[model samples]
Target: MIGIENIIFLIVAALGIGLFVWQIRKIRKNVLLGRDVELADNPSERINKTLLVAFGQQKMFKRMLPAVLHLFVYVGFIVINIEVLEILIDGIFGTHRVLGFVGPLYSGLMALNEILAALVIIACVMFLWRRNVTKVPRLATGVEMRAWPKVDANIILVVEIVLMLALFVFNIADMKRVLLAGEEVVGLYPVSQFFVDIFGEDPEQLYIIAKVGWWFHILGILAFMNYLPSSKHFHIIMAFPNVYYSKLLPKGKFTTNPAITHEIKAMLDPSYQPPAPEVDAEGNPVMQRFGAKDVEDLTWKQLMDSYTCTECGRCTSVCPANLTGKLLSPRKIIMDTRDRMEEKGEHPAIFAPNHYKELGVERVETTDEKTLLRGYITPEELWACTTCNACVESCPVNIDQVSTIMDLRRYLVLEESAAPASLNAMFTNIENNGAPWAFPASDRFNWADELYVPSKN
Candidate 1:
């Protein structure tokens, strides 16, 4: 048998280095996949952001039941790791049971851990059955589901299965330990005691069982550690920044029409991108995002927003367009943007027509029939959008589906000159007159039609 201290040192070093290298490589790959956003460079600020979002779980309250369940599971994690300390002690001395000053500390911890472990196990059971048995839209997935088509959901499903099942079985073993030994130095771990009372004396194999259980426990952890990088659980890394760097501004406050506050200005070009430097006679920047028709058209931050979506479909559930039976699913919109970005990965920007043919698809650009017919999305889905921010409001990750919709709208209006007749005419009239309705001012509101309604002074 190896010395306890040597084993402890080896495992800790392995875990630390393995996790570090794996996560670093994963993050670099994701960044290469168009996830570019600059967080504050200051150390304290970065630390603060990490703590509030990743640890604090600030935005996760939207789904209270799952949020609370996940919160308890996280606490359970801290508890179970305490047993690792006991293992280290045993590694140095050849026995894992607590001894000396920290003996009581660990014993008490084992009892607490046993209790939390039971709760965690129960929650896991409920969660698993809920996902597999219940037809909840979020969890009701079959072989055909995906955040992206080429992306396989099986990778994530398998990882989640391993992680949750390991926790479940590992906890059952800990409970067995607490129950088999009567009046252990550890206090009451009710669930185990309750179960053990149901099964007659089993003290004969307690120590052997503990050793076997511990081995399985460690192996399960090793598996999880190694598998972290290659799965959709990649969110485990992305979620940290996703929350910390979430949008602080309100939903409706998305953008102002380059609010023309200044009384005097000169140039006014509708095609202008940086309208501020090129503000017209009214001092308005014109909010010139003629819309993201292609991946390159998105801002670096917007690309980050795409990767951050959890594919949970909470956004789709609340979208007015989907509810009214319109083909527009906001969740689908965010999902497709992410998909297209992946399809275009590392490829230099070229006219869509020229490049898509290289990939064995007839549709290269958004204007093509394959794309318009919803190569990845349906046209009915496009027109169903009401431009409401409900999806944006509910998302914990600040995924700006509304902005994406506006960008597509911009592409249709400015590039294809296509839209619902009313909206198309409105756009034309906006160019013809200061507002959408281009009716003569003399006929406005039955005379004296020179009235403007500005809410602020």
Candidate 2:
């Protein structure tokens, strides 16, 4: 016979799962709105990258103190979740300590979980101190880290502490129940043992405490799962796949647009033939825009990178232009992309829908118009980048902020012809003289003449 508790548990679990799945679907849809990119070249290398970078937290170790603290939290999140399996089973069947049948091994696992949970609480506290007390420069006071991003970071740390505390309370109360029943305690509750003394020897009272703690802890996990899709904390889930699909080419290497490459080749070789236009499913030639003017113009991986951003500001901290007081903040570039993506998802016609309609697209233009280029990020910020790859090297999640900046620059220069006067002059010089200087190709050796090698002899 099924009990009311089991039925209620099933309903709540079903609702949580359903909501989480829906959020995942929405995120997938938003990411797919971007242009298709092929990153399927190397399978083994991808797997190795995911393991080394994501699982190993290789990049994070560059900051040793934070890395150690983060390792504790990360390991605790994985190891302590083992108890959640037992919680699920117990919830569904209305059984107590079902895994306790594994005897000493079960007790050992419980002890390990308790120790890890305590460590997680401690780590979270240190993380908060690092953010608030230490005031790390890298975790800047910019608009990117202000508002909801700031609150979200603190909330996650507080939530972890709360969850870990609940686990200890549950274990302590459970131990009290064992004492009252005159049964030998099963698990080695080292940290929770102190709690047993506080709660005292009443089985009935302890049982109530245990149930409350258990319910809160399990429900907290479910709530945390659903919260992930909407928060920067989504990196907890996205990091694995993001690192797997990371750019395998050298960090300094920039991706060339195939369309522009083809055009240049055609110019260089008279015999070169242009490829046929890309056709949609209905066989109509699809017009592809060059570079990223909006979120939808970026590659899906770039969109994914935005969501995976931890907002740590490591990229912005290392950015040479930002250090030089330029407008560019690599962190903001990613945050802006995410903000624009979410804005468009919510408002739909936030971008110039009328423009899309005039081009014969299905989307209709609306009065509310915005774009990533000017609305969320400015051309000033875009052009400030030095293309130094410092941001890429500093990123813990392998987010290629430089690539995103380059794509926006490409859209501005190639599509809109919106380059600054100096850049325009440089482009003209490159076109005519085959150099960035205004001098003719004949003057290419002029700089070499300035350097005297007679001293070497």
Candidate 3:
């Protein structure tokens, strides 16, 4: 006894599931192209943590107004969709008017739906007002901001308002159908009955209006669903996964080995890999400076951090380098990583393969002028970093850039035998005296009680 709409529902349901599976696979595949992949130990624990952070909105609730407004929008939108279940029922039975046993239940659901739809419309307006008046920083610094986003957001707001308005209109139309058909509408839904009282007329015309409104509402939802994956609204689709796998990594957690404390001569001049961390007699590691010359030198997890950046420009806003007029923006660091990844895409159009291969590594070894000056980072900014945690700490997605800088610093000091002249004596003092000082060893150990040091093994 199923109707044409029921058959269509089955097809759409199957297609939706298939598409969802495909997208999950695509996301996982794309993840490898990012930097981090380690599961961080226990899968179940991490999953629970991710779900709590995401669903609880515990972190977001701290932000106040946006959280409350967004919560209403999220809740109301979900409530409006409850009618979709009734739609499917109507599709199967060739009518949605659930009477008899569950008549009161249907009435209550309809009333709740109407109220929630209106709330959703109200929330959309509040969001647009915030964007225009308060000027959300995300909207302001957006690199691609132009006619499209402004138009899109405002248009979406309009659409939500119209859709909510249509719901009430449809309800009134439906009430008229109930009246003309000589059937009692379970009176739990007050809004539609009120409209029928104030504006009752010929029921046939109202029936047509009901169908038109229903069409608009259904079509709008479907169009928005398809658009969700492609628009800025993609965040809605992506936030769960994005926040779920978010880095629990502490600030400045170096994905690359922090430093090779003492240098071991590589077997080949192009530096075929050597055994790591050649150590001295005291069991301390003896490895020369450590650093990454290019993209491959960084670990896969580091790349993930770059890819995860929401491009919210939160880092750029707080960047001391940008403030000081230096070319370095922490935001640009991840953006540059993204650019480099794109540049090396499967079939890159133009490539200068290793044309400037002699990185700070080769340059320091050869004392090459090209490497010393005008490298990826200027010496001034390199030295200027106060190890300030501002950029990384502020980043909502927790992209780490300072650690990359530190790795470069390690290479300069350890492997290349390159240090500013003033630092040479300091390095010498540390190297010869087992510490970075010209002061006597007794004085260094003086903080500990003399009795505590001498009698020790």
Candidate 4:
């Protein structure tokens, strides 16, 4: 019973899904290239946080106008996709309105979908206007936003508009076709009904237009699916898991290195002993690096954070260092991480050959000397951060930008001994005087002594 059109649809669907899955797998492999860290504690709390931050979009409400517009696009796009299921069924079985058998329920669903599609088109237009016409400072002015990032944003918005248009065209043409045949239209087309006259009363012409629109809509969805992995729109999928695994600790609390903590403990207590070093596959002892010199040194969650970034620039807009004209932009930091990951991903053999070598399989070597720290992100940018969690609080997805910054700082200080001059002095004071002040511990109470007289009451 299968027709040529149905067979072609099946092949295209299979190919699209296969390509999407392959890219997703590659992204997973890249994310897993980072060191592992446990974030599984408090599962219930994490789920609640995910619902509030990702699903509820609580953090985005800080800026009301964009929030409302984004909500329209977000909700409309998702709800409208219910029609994609019907489209899929119709495409595969070569049936017209396959879900039309649902009777009046189908009418209600179609009406709702038509309304949402219209809203989505409106939202996407406003979004485009904001980016191009209004030139919103945060969205427009970042070094990272130049060229491809800007183009990518516009592409997604325009694509959404076109897809919504295609839906309307398909509906209008189908309604015209039904009317021409003197058959009862199965579904309500509130938005499309107004435009049905545009296609004329020619049944064959309506049929062709309907088929074209249907094909374009489904094909566009498949193309958009594959494009997500390379676009900031990936956050649509990544945000939930990223928010779920986000740090639950207080913003001001910094995570200390376990090795450094053990060393401090040993120094403070004569009876304390450090834990034994981890051993490799051959029983050779493995030493831990001080901090993140590259993406591999960062936690997998941090890498996911990079991929999940919406590039909204809310974080950068709130950043004190950037406001003061410093080299640091929190948005840039995340973008750089993602760029570095992509660079490394392209040359898997040079960075991640152990897996292949272990399996006795050879991979081509593509040598590149770049690293996340010096190559993509600079030392000045890392040091410019004030350790304030303003960026963290501003992020809609709850990306821990500060944590990544701190890890890079740790690598600079512990591994390279490259802390800033002022910080180096403070470190010396802490070591010799047990405080950040330059005065020795013996003189610590001198100011208090001067204030305290032999006052006997």
Q: Cα lDDT of all candidates, in order?
A: 0.56, 0.83, 0.57, 0.86
- How would you encode candidate 3's per-residue C-alpha lDDT over 21-120 as one tens digit per residue? 5544543444454333464576676577566655655544645776777677766676777776565455456665544347667767777877677677
lDDT leaderboard ranking: 4, 2, 3, 1
lDDT of 4 by residue, 146-260 (tens): 5678888999999999999999989999999998899999989899988989998889999999999999999999999988888888999999999999999999998877878
The reply for model 3, stretches above 4 Å from the true place, is 1-29, 97-106, 134-138, 141-149, 186-200, 256-457
Instruction: Report clash pairs, candidate 2.
Output: 353-365, 354-365
TM-score of 1: 0.66
Ranking by TM-score: 4, 2, 1, 3
Q: Of models 1 and 3, which has the larger lDDT?
A: 3
Show how many residue pairs clash in every candidate, following the order shown.
Answer: 6, 2, 17, 0
The most accurate candidate by lDDT is: 4
lDDT of 2 by residue, 353-447 (tens): 11322344222221224888776677888888889999999888899898899999999988999999999999999999999988889978887
RMSD (Å) of each candidate, 1 decimal: 8.5, 5.5, 9.8, 6.2
TM-score: model 4 vs. ground truth: 0.92
Q: What is the C-alpha lDDT profile of model 1 across 290-313, one tens digit per residue? A: 554666555555655656666666
Better model by TM-score, 1 or 2? 2
- Please identify model 1 stretches exceeding 4 Å from their true place: 1-20, 32-63, 78-105, 141-190, 193-208, 226-232, 255-290, 294-296, 340-382, 412-421, 442-457
Model 4 scores a C-alpha lDDT of: 0.86
